[model samples]
Target: MRGLSWQIGLRYSMDRSGNQLVSFLSRLSMLGLILGVALLVVVLSVMNGFDQEMRSRILSLVPHITFQPWQQDRGDWQTLKAEVEQHPSVTAAAPFLQGNVMLIKGNAVEPSLLLGIDAAAERKVSRVGDFVDLGLLEGNREGLVLGDALAKKLGVEVGENISLGIPQSSDSNDVRFAKLPVLATVATGTELDQQLLLSSLETAARLLPSGQTLSLRVSIDDVFNAPRVAWELASVHGQDYIIRDWSQQFGNMYHAIQMSRKLVVIMLLAVVAVAIFNVVSTLVMVVNDKSADIAILRSQGASQGDILRIFLVYGAVIAGVGALAGGVLGVLLALGIGDIVAAIENALDMKLLQSDVYPINYLPSALRWGDIASVCGTAYVMSLVATLYPAWRASRMPPAEALRHG
Candidate 1:
């Protein structure tokens, strides 16, 4: 069997014109495979990276589940949190006070979303403490943790004091304003970095004349299970509160990434298709150049099927070689591009990962095995299909007439 295979390979290689045509076709195939694989790897990696970054920045700070009452602006958060915790999917639940408030520091003023959370409870649900440095609550109900951008805008440092004022009551003429001490600085490269504030729930409750908590934050066992868990929680809680998922708030960006990924796939497929066509053309040329040999084989009682198989195997070799080369090259390029770009950016003193300009920094690449397999498989299949017609045409040649003419 091994000797037979070697004989077939030797015959295939000895056909000079056939080998040249196949080599040319193989080069074109390699070009297509290289581009397609490289693009697929790079794009999917980028999308995966972006998706991960978004999840980390958004989910790390925001709860997987948020409970906001439908009819009432405020609710008994402690009771609701306790009730929600009974569910197996529910991991930790915390009370939160959320409202729009203004911060005044060193003659500069900025508007922000005031999130009042119990320090201990927040630790259970989110990573606020890790992001926040230089904060000491110590039961100081009037302390605040400010976003890094907001702090810079207000020209306030970690130890600096800032004035936080709630809107005065409409009916009463008292000019009392809620002022707080700035305790910490948080710098997460997100929208929250510019317009989010952290304070004690007690302080928030006191600031509001109504003295009510608006929402309760819940963290689930798995983040991807947020919607399912939220649905179950809502089913249990009844119509009093509405469930909100991170997707609902940020679906546009996710959808955009998905659309871009699809477009990339289409583009890469076009390149592969072009490569297949090149292979088909190369096979046709090979069949023409090997017509004399084909005639001899036909006279030797070789079946048409055998002739087709030989040519098919020849095309397969070319396609397989190119696919292998492309796959290896693509992976190497994808894995190293991020580090290469980062290094260049650093040497040039240019911020490739700009926090102030963009939401996140650092080029991210995440290659999936599925994408690689799909690209390589598609190339091989296309190349084989493309070989059929030309090989079949060569196989059907008249052996007697060709031998007499030659």
Candidate 2:
């Protein structure tokens, strides 16, 4: 009986060779399902890729947590660092000093951030030296390394003297100046690249009284737990210590990415829902067109259950073909998205994202089988639901009434 029902369902689905609207609607149903699933796969993978780039490329430059003394007196940084490193979440810790200084070249001058770091220790927490133009991060003691943007603005390069204007005393309004040779430049590809200058702690100490201010910057195993880890740092360091995390500076951007992901998913789900429900109209029309065939079958000893099974088989086959094609195509698109985006960018002669403004210079994509499974499951379920009402209607038709009415 099931084999007979399948034969009839397959024939009905394929018998739309003459009618234009039936053929058109059938094609439209498949097209909608294909496009909907493909879109979800491509878009969500891009979002996941962006989230990954933000964490690995951008966050690698900043400390996840910082421990500073509220009072100006410096704590025993070596001991404190040792203690902080014991935490399972903590990856590396380094001491740093930050000060505002002005860089003056031959004719241009700019305000810059003087970041004092211990090269050996800083290497553990930051990727500053990894992406330099020349072999610049050799850390010539008492020398300076400027960010690419900062160096360009000042019209200086390696082996140039840039005068640093530093305040002489906190007691009075005296300003002292020191001439430092630019050693190397770094490009972080971030806004931080505009005004950042890396100097050894020796240089910063020589320029400014060092013992008064030094902070411990720590990196963590997980970016999301930075704030909680920071709180733990504070609690362990006692009330006199102050704590800050990268989330305090970059949390809003991370939050915006997450919110956009959710919003995009919700909006696309609506689109897929519309496409899936379009199956209802197509199936209903099929039922109407085949009512006579259904009557003939009923009169020939086929039960209502048989009639119902026939249409159900028809609907399932339609959904399965559409979904299978969509799933395959979507995964293919997701896998090739990076190359696809690059081609589009080259053809348009414009970039989708600017590295300095956005976290990455290009769109990224990662296809996870789990996400594909979720999309396929949802599409299949929606298509099945859409088939139910029309299938049920076809089963309830009275054979004599349908034949007489026709």
Best-performing candidate as measured by lDDT? 2
Task: Output the worst ten-in-a-row residue range by lDDT, candidate 1.
Answer: 1-10
Error (Å) of candidate 2 at residue 296 is: 1.6
Query: Whole-model lDDT for model 1 versus the true structure?
Result: 0.73
Candidate 1 residue-wise lDDT, 132-203, digit = tens: 742364374568888787888999887667887665555665444666677888887665677768887777
Task: Compute each candidate's TM-score over C-alphas.
Answer: 0.79, 0.87
CA deviation > 4 Å runs, candidate 2: 102-111, 133-135, 139-143, 146-196, 207-212, 404-406
lDDT of each: 0.73, 0.82
**Cα lDDT, model 1, residue 238:** 55
Candidate 2 Cα deviation (angstroms), residue 403: 3.3
Per residue, candidate 2 scores C-alpha lDDT tens digits across 126-225 of: 7766776323433546688887877888889889888988876678777779998988877766656776788887678778754557788898998889
